[model samples]
Target: MYNSQEIVSISNRNIPSLITLPAELVYSILDNLDMLTILISFCNVCKRLKNITNTYHRYKTFTILNLTHHRINEQEFECLVNTLQNNKTLIEIHLRCNKIDNQKTKSLTDVLKTNTILTTLVLSNNTISTDGAQYLANLLNNNKTLKELDLGWNQITSEGIRYIADALNNNHTLTILNLQINNLGNQGTQYLTNALENNRTLMTLILSNNCIDYEGAQYLANMLCKNKTLTTLILSDNRIGSQGVKYLANALYNNKTLTKLHLRLNRINSDGAKYLADALHNNNTLTELHLGWNDIGNQGVQYLSNALYNNHTLHILHLQYNKIDCIGAQYIADALQKNTTLRELYLACNKIKNQGAQYLLNILKNNQTLTTINIQSNKIDFHEIQYLIDILEKQRIQF
Candidate 1:
């Protein structure tokens, strides 16, 4: 943090000051600073400082520029993008919660078209709608190096998604796409899945809270039958009822690529859990399954517990906020005795009382594979929690 202007002005006279620090010391300082500070201020100090910055390996490798929630406006955002236009080392830029609108998105698109190094762009929680999406869609066609794009919490409608879907057909580098909380209903989901059938590079697709129901899920199920690259699909907070779950479960039987599926808050009930449980019986590829905030009761938990007996691949299972009671907890506890591959189990916000809690705590003595087990917000009182803590040495138990 040396003062650059008065490098020689002890003038008060001519003594060597901290501003005359060596290149090595300056490089060490650059290692800890963000890209904005290094580029906008440090690099502008002098020719010597700029040269030292260009050669700083630590600075060069610090590629991610995250300005999330900075609340930057149009002029500031344009200036920021313009400053980063020619940066070759930055690979990711996060601008979430900024006040970027359609015009600012255009500025970003224009800047990103020529920047070959940047691969991830997160513009979530912004004000960009349909027109802004079109700008980004156009950028996708020109920028072949971008690998991840998060446009969640926007108002990009079904119509805007069409442009992105069309662009995906030709785009080969983008791998992760997050469109969560966007009002892209069934039609948008259809467009994206149709394009994904041919696209091979994309692996993670998040479409949570999109107003999609059985019809939209059916399209995705059909696409999953043929697509062999997608690995993670998050469809939480939709209307993917039991019938929708049925379609996805059938697809999972054939899908050998997907490893994670999130269907929380989808209005799924006992029938839906049964469908997914049946799929888990034969499907060995999925590693994480999130089914929280549903009505998968004791019967549904029983069905899933039975599947866990034979399943060897699943590592994480989230059943939180479901209508699971003491019986459901017992079912899960019984399965843990034999299921060694399962590592994380989430049973929060359930109705499991002392008896059911004891069952799970006792089984943990033999089940060493479980690294994480969340039992918070359940019906177990503080005394039972303290009892478990004493037995587990406060090291193994996390309540």
Candidate 2:
């Protein structure tokens, strides 16, 4: 419809410029271009290109880099460490289940000295040796930004824990530390808890599956008496028997900061429950107690139930797989009628039959604070509990 010259002029305006391309495509083009071309030759020629360059630079500033299960070896991880040297915005580095070992731990930890914003470094489930913990210890000694360091499921032994304990003695910024399932025997726990005596910043310390018994627990109890900062302590899957709980319970009588204590599968029996109950009677800060799977029979529940009548701070209690029968269910039901603070009670995998279910049903009608109750695997028929569930709000009961 137009002349050749007029049509050619209109086509010139319709031609797509590099700035009009897709964002990813433009970024790819910039990645291939040199600095001089980006700054002087190409980007300066277009106003939209400058805006794209700003986005390009912003996209590269990674704050939370999660390269989990990437199998990144020492050589590949060295490049990441080099990038972190200049990355001030990065706060968390999760290289969990990577191929990191003890040989090149220096390059990995050396860059942390220059980084000021990184707060969490999770390197759990790695092959880092006991020797590698020395480098981590060095980082923790002077680094100020790191708050939580998870070195769980590694091969760090007693000697390695000694290195970390020495660092804790001087470090002040780190708060949450996880050293679980590392074969840190009582000797290693002794070294770590001894360091905790001087530490002022740490709040949560997890030492689950560390082969710790009463001797290691004694060290922690001793530290808790003097250290008033720690709140949550998890000692699950260890060999801490009745004596270990006794040692910790003795500390709880005076420790005003501790709120949650997890001692599941630690071989605690009726005697251990009595020790904990005695402490609960005097301690006012503890809110959650996990003591599942330790064969604490009806007698143990009686002890805990008796304490609950006076304990007003506890909100959650886990007693699953503790051999609790109908008698134990009655004990808990009686306590809930008077106690008004508890919200969740996990009693799964017990021997609570239809009679036990009825006891809980009668109490749930009157108890307003108790919201969640897990009675799964308690050998009770659904029909036995459904009639009660129909009367009250069924949302609180988990069969």
Q: Which ten residues in a row have the lowest lDDT in candidate 1?
A: 9-18
Q: What is the C-alpha lDDT of each candidate?
A: 0.88, 0.88
Tell me the spans in candidate 1 whose CA falls farther than 4 Å from its real position.
1-62, 382-389
Model 1 lDDT per residue over 78-131, tens place: 556655765668888999998778988988898888778888999999888989
Instruction: Give all TM-scores, in the order shown.
Output: 0.87, 0.87
Q: How many backbone clashes does candidate 1 have?
A: 1
Give candidate 1's root-mean-square deviation (CA, Å). 5.5
Q: lDDT at 383 for candidate 2? A: 81
lDDT of 1 at 369: 92
Q: Give the range of the ten consecutive residues with the poorest summed lDDT in model 2.
A: 35-44
